[model samples]
Target: MSGITENTKTSGEPSKENPSPNSSDTPDDEKKDDRMFECNICLDTAKDAVVSMCGHLFCWPCLHQWLETRPNRQVCPVCKASISKEKVVPLYGRGSTKQEDPREKVPPRPAGQRTEPEPGSAFPGFGFADNGFHMSFGIGAFPFGFFTSTFNFGEARPTPAARGTQQHMEEQFLSKIFLWMAILFVAWLLLA
Candidate 1:
């Protein structure tokens, strides 16, 4: 990656445009290099540069401010591609020195994320092999056993959601529907 200058003029700061360098004086390679690293948002050399997943360059500060200005819709300034602060990849140029303290209010550019590789098992065993002993006690009497198992006697169950919440209302509605269905099933069984 090409080096970006840290002390370069920010978009917010005043700057004078240099007269176009004579084609004969400046090499074609140098001219291309200068324009290549410019931030899409600030239209200047990128400082604390980051590249969007869509491959557009930006100064982290400029991009952060742009995102802040329009919180609802965040997209690439160049391509209008979907973007977010967390998803942008920071560029670390060679010989770039870290500043001791940040002078600007904008937070530091996001770091690259790394994840560990999944472990490989030599032999995949049946899932139940490691669970050890299993035991169950059942009352042989038909009516009592059905009640005990169906009601999950002495087993912990999740408490209902708070009364006024949408989740609670949905649960109550579903419960009533299931209760009616069960009653209809019992009635059908007796008639048949």
Candidate 2:
């Protein structure tokens, strides 16, 4: 009876000294590994890849379509960080040359945004003078005139207005006006 019990225990449990053939650590096993550079949206190897600020990788087409789908809320699909067409960085790789040209699509991948470095403190000529002020005004004919604006700033650029102030009230009014204009424009497009 004791011998029978011992035999059952040995059969039921695996031996520690000898590992199973199915173990993943075995170097002799040939398994196909999926590439790490897969698109978050399409689940395929990323082509014309772009990396989000949050560091998730995706194919540019997939990300662009996603952004177009929800133009109002442009956020990263993986991390939900605030992202926009201007924010994504395009990846250029040796293999990218072999991929199909991305320009054939309706909306091509967004161009990377580049800004010139700010003038250093030593370069005083480029900066605003102590009492010097700057203002710019442009008057485009008719329809484009609404888009144009005149900006005036003193020695220091004007800061944003605090809530509940007259300046804030004016800003809110202008925002609503623009919002209504945009809605009207869309409605006109649909009718046309």
State the weakest 10-residue window (summed lDDT) of model 1. Answer: 1-10
- Give the Å shift of residue 159 in candidate 2: 23
Q: In model 1, which regions exceed 4 Å deviation?
A: 1-26, 99-105, 108-192
Task: Please give the RMSD to the true structure for each candidate, in Å.
Answer: 16.9, 19.8
Q: How many angstroms is residue 41 displaced in model 2 relative to the true structure, after the best TM-score fit?
A: 0.2
lDDT for each residue of candidate 2 in 102-154, tens digit (9 for 90 to 100): 43353854576677665445434333453323333333553555344432222
Candidate 2: Cα lDDT at 95: 39
Residue 2, candidate 2: alpha-carbon lDDT: 45
**Model 2, which residues run further than 4 Å from truth?**
1-33, 98-192
User: lDDT values of the candidates?
Assistant: 0.61, 0.60
